[model samples]
Target: MQIIEQQIKTKLSSSAKFYGYIPDVSQEIDPAAERPSVLICPGGGYVMTSDREAEPVALNFVAAGFNAFVLRYSIAPARYPVALLEVASAMKLIRKNSAAWHVDPKRVIIAGFSAGGHLAANFATSWDRDLVTEYGYHADEIQPNGLFLGYSVITSGKYAHVDSFKNLLGDRYGEPELMSKVSLEKQVTKSTPPAFIWHTVSDDTVPVENSLLFAEALEAHQISFELHLFPKGGHGLSLGTSATAIKSNGYGLEPTVSAWRDLFVAWVQNNI
Candidate 1:
C-alpha cells in the first residue's frame, strides 16, 4: 500500500490538504489495474474536520478494493467557496495523476459526513458551473461520478444545520438569499450524479430531513439514488463502530449503523 499526502492549495486558501491510501499492485497480479476512488470529506459543522471520519473511513474503503482519499478541506475561518474550490483542486489533482495513481478517473466518487457532505453534494450538483471554470478547472475536470453522503448538512432552511451554514457563509450568513443559495436541496439538478445517502432518523443535531430533502430533490430530477434511514443513532457517527468511537464519550459505536460502510461498498459495486 502507498500513503500519499499533498497540500491542496486553491485561489481561496492554502490550508487544505489531501491524503491518499492506494494499494500497491502485484507484478504477478493485476499490475495494470485502474481502480475506482473515493475522496472523503470529514464533517465538522464547517468548524473543523473530524479525525474519526478521515483516515479510518478511507482505509475501510481501501480494504474494500478501491483507492481512497481524505480531504482535510478548509473550515469555518475559510468560508464558502474556499472549501468548495479546495475540493475542486483535489479532484483536479486526482484526475491529473489518475494514471500514476492507478485510478479510473471516470469512477471517482465523493463521500462526506455532516458539513463535509454539503461540500461534496455542492460539488456534485454544481461542478458544471462557471465558478469552477473561473478557478482554472474545466467543469468536467472536477465532476464526481457518484456521491455518498452520511448524515449530511444539506439545507440552509428549516431543516438546515444552522451553525454549518453560519460558519460557511460568515458575513453572508445574514443575507437570506445567499443562505438559500447554499441550500443543497435547492441546488440539485438533472446533471447531478448518482448518490447513496444515509442518515439516522433520530439524529437531532443535523436532523434526518437534511438527507431526505436532498434525496427528494434527486428523485424529483429523475436522478439515480439510494437512501437508507436508520431507525436510530445520532449525528457524526463515522463508522458507527468501536474503530471510530470517541474513547471518552463512546460517541460513535453503534452496531446497527456500522453497516453503512458495507452497504456503501455494495452500492458502488452495483451502481458506480
Candidate 2:
C-alpha cells in the first residue's frame, strides 16, 4: 500500500490537508487493476475535523478494496465556499491523477461524516455551479459518482445543526437566501448522484430528519438513494464501533450501527 499526504491550498484557505491510501498493485496480482475510490470529509461541525473519522474510516475502505482519500477541510473562521472549494480541489486532484493512481474515475465516490456530509452533499448537488467553475475546475472534473453520508447535517432549517451552519456561513448564518442555499435538501437535483445515507433516529445533535429531508428531495427528483435509519446511537458515531470510541466513552459504539460500513460497501458495489 502507498500512503500520500499533501497540503491542499485553495484561494480561500491554505491549511487544508489531503491524505490518500492507495493500494500498490503488482504484476503478480492484477497489473491492470483500476480501483474505485472514496474521498472522505471528516466532520467537526465546521470547527475541526474529527480524528476518529479520518484514517480509521479510510483504512476500512482501503481494506475493502477501494482507494481512499481523506480531506481535513478548513473549518470555522473560514466560511462558506472555502471548504467547499477545498473539496473541489481534492476531487480535481483525484481525477487529475486517476490513471497514475490506478483509479477508475467513473467510480469515484465522496463520503462524509456529520458536517463534512454537508460539504459532500453540497458538492454533489452543486458541482455545476459557478463557484466551482470559477475555481478553475470543470464540473466533470469534480463530480462524484456516488455519495455516502454518515449522521450528516443536511438542512439549514428546523432540523439543521445550528452550529455547523453558523460556522459555515459565519456572519451570513441567518441570511435567508444563503441559509436556503445551504439547506441541501432543497438543493438536490437530477444532476445529483445516487446516495447511501445512514443516521440514527436517536441522534439529538443533528437529528435524523436531516437525512430524511435529503432523501425526500432525492426521491422527489427521481434520483436513486438508499437511506438507513438505525434505532439507536447518537451523532458523530463514525463507525459506531469500539474503533471509533472516544477515550473511555463508549457512547459512540452501537453494534447495530456498525453494520453501516459493510452496507455501504455493498451499496457501492451494486449502485456505484
Best of the candidates, lDDT: 2
TM-score, each model? Answer: 0.98, 0.98
Cα TM-score of candidate 2: 0.98
Report the lDDT of model 1 for residue 261. Answer: 83
Model 2 over residues 220-259: C-alpha lDDT tens digits?
9999999999998878888877888887756687788989
Worst 10 residues of 1 by lDDT: 128-137
Q: How far out, in Å, is residue 208 in model 1?
A: 0.4
Give the runs in model 1 whose Cα sits over 4 Å from its true position.
none
lDDT of 1 by residue, 139-242 (tens): 77788999999999999888888889889999889687787779999999888999999999999899899998998999999999999999988888899988
What is candidate 1's local distance difference test score? 0.91
Residue 141 displacement in candidate 2 (angstroms): 1.1
